[model samples]
Target: MASSTVNRWLRPEVYPLFAAVGVAVGICGFQLVRNICTNPEVRVTKENRAAGVLDNFDEGEKYSQHFVRRFVRNKSPEIMPSINSFFSDPKL
Candidate 1:
């Protein structure tokens, strides 16, 4: 009589626990996929390849220096104020 009562109390509860865990796992998987699909910056549509352009070139340092010199702008010379515009100058 006691064995029958024990089985009856535990049998239905185990199925509900399994169902709850399954639902939790499904929800987590759905959220993970949704986040990955929403982000756009990391997409790679280009046919990217290893930079195999320099296999023939040995003087890479000269090319690098030339590119840097072209990219950088030189600072302008400081302006001096005339006698009339002396009040406009910050140095005054």
Candidate 2:
């Protein structure tokens, strides 16, 4: 009886969990692409690594990116131009 119940779950009911996992993986992939596209430094680092120029990841003064810290520090300068244009521009 226990084996039968486990089998039932292992067949059809397990699919929803699999679907949810697939969706989650897809979302994560999209977020990774979005991050690469938005951060020029990160994108450059990735390219360097791919090209083998950045062979030793631990070789220097290089440190992990703290996106939140950098984003917070740079937010005002980053946002002001876009915000100004957003308000100034008229819609077609």
Candidate 3:
């Protein structure tokens, strides 16, 4: 019964929905982890607590320059830039 249900969902017509769901889940997971690891208000460690510092200035600065942070920071806000541009073009 379970195998039949799995086979039904594995059809090509359902692939795009699965891909979209997977991407959404991946993005949400990444953001959740990034915020937990980097956001000063939510991240608390023994070093930070013992030091009596609410915010780790140096660590924050260092993390801001990390490759992933830099890439995300500089990335365009648009999700589909090409399609957006094509539709918005005055000449179209």
Best by TM-score: 3
lDDT of 2 by residue, 48-77 (tens): 657643445553223344555565765665
lDDT of 2: 0.66
Q: In candidate 2, residue 42 scores what lDDT? A: 58
Estimate the TM-score for candidate 2.
0.35
Rank ordering of all candidates by lDDT, starting from the highest = 3, 2, 1
Native-to-model Cα distance after best TM-score fit, residue 69 in candidate 3, in Å = 9.7
Best by lDDT: 3
Model 1 C-alpha lDDT per residue in residues 1-92, reported as the tens digit of each score: 99998787668768898788889999999767744553232233343234333343444444444544765546333354365367765783
Candidate 3 local lDDT, 5-70, one digit each (tens): 999998999999999999999999998898888866563676665765455687778766888767
What is the total number of backbone clashes in candidate 2? Answer: 0
TM-score per candidate, chains pooled: 0.31, 0.35, 0.54
